[model samples]
Target chain A: MSAQDLDGGSDAEADGSGEMPKPHTIRLELADEPGQLLAALAPISDNGGNLLSIFHERGNLTPRGHIPVEVDLECPPDRFERIVDALRDAGVNVIRAGAEHFGEEVMVILVGDTVDSDLSDTLHRIESSADATLQDLSLSAREGTDEASSARLRLAVRSGRVDETLAVVRDLAAEKGLHVVEPLAEGSQ
Target chain B: MSLRLAVLGAGAVGGSVLDLAGDYGHDVVAFADSSSSAVDPAGLDPSAVHDRKERDGVVGDADPESVFDADYDVLVEATPTTLGDAEPGFSHVERALADDRHVVLANKGPVAERYADLRALEAESEGTVQFEAAVGGAIPILSTISDLGAPHVTAARGVLNGTANFILSRMAAEGLDYEHVLAEAQDLGVAEADPTFDVDGIDAALKFVILANVLSDGETEYALDDAEVEGIRNVPGTALDLAAEDGRTVRLIGEATADGVRVAPRLIPQGSALSVTGTQNIVQLETKHAGQLNISGRGAGGPETATAVLSDVSRLE
Candidate 1:
């Protein structure tokens, strides 16, 4: 696949295909070489990743004396993981790889019958729903699966999609008979 | 770099590949059908050979034997599926692999009937074998599980045969008998006139064998006979009706585990993953890390099967 500089603004909004291209930033520690930056960018472009920008820190160096470069690219959700995989396969050292603007994260608590009702499937449904991705998950079932228990989930949603993502989670929780403890808005004094 | 290809069997599957290979950056340098064959070091005109076959039942002036010496990087085997010894197809693959040329198979015969022998051939040969189209026409079933890594994939189950699944689904939804549905499926070109391989579960069993072997990671060798096969021929409409009463649908599911492989009609709960209708085929992989990944799509079609073959060609190193 060839990469095109995805025309115009944020590709995060759904294209006519009904699938959004998420913009992601990848931080990499590259050895100081003539074509190291070029080598790293090849994989991103080859695996259907659209080049957005490159923040090549030629003036600075990391502790190990390697230049740290951050690449900004956009690709469909399905293609993002593959670009990362291809980059790694090409021997690029990735420091951080994720969405650049999942600007909001919410921690929701679920209580009652998490395990017996299939918690894994519920989480799977939320992620596959495409509005958000699960950032972290923690479950506390001290008593037992049969008894009431609570699970914590940190969901990373697009900047403007926090409410929509939460609504999906709430609906899924309601169907499973789980109580939702919504995370309060930031800085409530 | 564009790879040169020599396609054997020149039927629908092979013809589609011959017709569509150029769009995917593959050049068909040579091709062979039953009666005649053609070869060119640069590239063959796909339309020219197709027209020849349509008019004269042959592809070219050259004999079929010339395919062995054709100048190509990958040899595509798209012959008919044969059981037991897996004749001409096996010989075709053996010849290609022995020459250290990569092979892509849409034919189920060599892989199903003689997996052990084929594996042995692949072990010594410099070339590799890819058969994604053999199991599911357009769905990347084998490549998906294989790319997920064999260790991660624990089990695989799916609705593999479109014909059998179509027959069974229509019987349930229409409340029709097996014979009536089978006839309807045949009329719709979903089932072949000689539908024994599909209805008797041999086709599904062959796919399960391929899946089992792929999941085994070369540790286990599974032949067509290794699977305990049961077709949907005896599946009565009454059984489907009884299943429907309980909010279930009967589907012919092919399952492969580390222990064994089998194909039989099983009742799945409504809205379940395997409850696909018509000619859709689905394969669900049970993985250790990731959850079940279900891939469903057209199981068999000329262009679809050719696309799988071309995808394999593209992945050939």
Candidate 2:
């Protein structure tokens, strides 16, 4: 993970004057090489983009055995497309690139008969109803599926949508007689 | 100034108040359990009262109703918390206020459940009401809010219940189940024999409801029924394990704003101010001018809570 410099410089002439530099997130898949992250980040800075943060998921891997990296940068509307094209042009596999997508991650634990309640269906409902993406899940039912079980879910939600997502989760859990332990809002701690 | 005090309820808080009132330069003129009372115009001996209560199960030979007849300046209400109507505690406070006497409460029921009625009674009389012990014990939460001005304080939140926090912290620390940790807490006397009030989030909810009532400043009244509460009973060890993996831990946190109160097991970053382990408690106040203020201390205990009650007594003119 790279340090997030929220003050991403005042150099905003990449896409001409009178246009504000909007934040954009780009996801890339890299091989397990020494310079893979450095190589992947080069195209972002080379395309006149100001780097904001680099979330390097070293412990996590793509299905094809590649490291996943999420880079947040500030660029004008037209320049964001150019940065994505330049990354692919430089042979960096750009998996996802967008401005109005996942901006924050929230984790919650749901405890109940998750297995018998059709956990997959519950996940689908959460994703659709909450406008969130199922990022990861870890279910523990050591007492067997017949008994109470707990599942920890990591959901990728758009920024400022955490409260809405949690309300949806609480409603769904209530319907199934499940309990949801939500993460406290950022900075409230 | 030395003032005469009539303490209600002979529980831990009331007993400690009787024992320590002399040290604080006050006199317990009257003391009562539910059944009996002890009154001396000057001051009763604390040890003698304790011995009589221990041996005969009565604080004194006087009738419980006779406590009101004693010449006391402050009424210390430390009865067990009751919900809904808040019981005889409310009636005791009402009687004290009607006599133009100050009331210092260690009981949460009257404050949390019947805030409007209590304040109305206070408004009708010349006396004032201060209930610092009703919130975070010995943490001076209410006094700090008073110093900062309740309007300047935006919100209040923390691990208010020590018993629930003890169970959660022990579960996270030893990777034990909730029942196992709760049993250990019971054996250690950190939790009561019937842990429903503590573990089910009622105790914490009541405290936060009191905070909410205070923060509202008589604009909006809050009660235990208004709080959205969730206990720590359903939180498994695996959930804590997962939170620990991400540099976080689960705490039975409660929040109170002018809007309302909420108590639940939420994930907070490990080592944060709110992540107090064992039977420790912490309170975070969101203020308008001061950014954020964190006050941590023993939230509940005989001596610890007596300090709050005594401090409230001293604040009264």
Candidate 3:
């Protein structure tokens, strides 16, 4: 969340090499409580998302009777998913997000030493190496990491890079002695 | 949940909606045409009303004005297209929105000519306006843009007018002149008897303006006059032939750009996305991140257009 660590996320990155930040707009439904706007804005700034502007439509109420808020921000595409997650984690209702999500998406399951292998680092490496973005993830360690823990990952990769992205994950999983359940592989029955 | 419905303009589109609403668990509480209308609190029989209108030339005892006051959850406006001021269609939408009723518009007038006004009305009203049938009859183009969100659609363009496309396609394939093909289209009911609106590119331009406004997310509210329109009326068969020699075909393409809306006949390579023939309509959206999205289907028909209207109704909360 540090400004100095802008390129730290697995979704989008701005390496301070002068890449123009991508502009995104998110439509939200917020309770008309005091500090709701601030509570919403905190996660955006926390995730290295540059604030562009916010239009809190005080007069208009969505179907849920909550005030409609439109927030415009600029960030690298790689970091957008993280910013979205941070907003949701902060309990902000996101009705709409950035339009330019990755075109192709795939789901894979990894079983074996998930916690010990450092899932966050593995996700970051896959996104950075394969030019893929992590979307939704589910981790389960019911039997504890000593036996086998499984994690389900939903990834949004650039079109035509699904095979390569899966390969990157497979290579990393091989080195870590983790078993990968491939869903996007051509030979998968 | 059964939806109480009020339908305006019981023409091809409206009548079709009346016919199919029951299948979707929606009841046409009130139905209106230009001359006579029917308003019922419970539910109106679609067959009885349609038969009365066609057989006896009268729909019901109530006048069109009474339809406005009818109790209903949603107002389906299927009126004919009237450019310029957009007339009764615009006023119908305004009244429905003001009365806190959701509106599903198959008419192009309110959305195309009066987009900004409609947006203001929608912002103030509890009810929302959906017009999937306005642009592409059953192609789901407008809603697709909404689903994709506004900022991502960098540019959108396509062949919007089926009548124009039909005429041009026939002229290209059969080696017939524009006049001959247009006459054939009229006989086949593919083009209107007057055919001025479609051939002169005004119809396509209106739909293009609507698409532009929707894609921009109201960043740009393009008026009918703002578009630079050149219809396919003057297109000759020889031109299509010449284009065909180079593996190209002439099509009436309506495009929305950052500058403004434009409608004209352009030569595209055969088998390309925009090279659709006959009454087929194609919409292609150039997105910022999701690459390009292309949707094509029948652009206009009684059942096809009504299907779009019914889809909008089902989408209503």
lDDT of 3 by residue, A24-140 (tens): 766677899899999999999999889988867564465577876778889877667788889889998886576344679776656565433467557646755785766656665
Please provide, for model 2 over B30-82, each residue's C-alpha lDDT reduced to its tens digit, 9 standing for 90 to 100.
99999999999989999999999989999999999999999999999998999
- CA lDDT, every model vs. true structure: 0.79, 0.86, 0.79
Give the interface RMSD values of the models in order: 20.7, 2.1, 26.4
Per-residue lDDT tens digits for candidate 3, residues B102-220, read 99999999888889999999999999999998888989887888888878888788888899999999988997777778889999999988988999999899888988898878777
Worst 10 residues of 1 chain A by lDDT: A1-10
- Pitting candidate 1 against candidate 2, the one with the higher TM-score is 2
True-contact fraction in model 2 equals: 0.46
Which pairs of residues have clashing backbones in candidate 2?
A: none
User: Mind giving the per-residue lDDT tens digits that candidate 1 earns over B45-73?
Assistant: 99999898998889999998898888889
On lDDT, the candidate that comes out on top is 2
Off by over 4 Å in 2: A1-100, A115-117, A143-147, A186-189
TM-score of each: 0.62, 0.81, 0.63
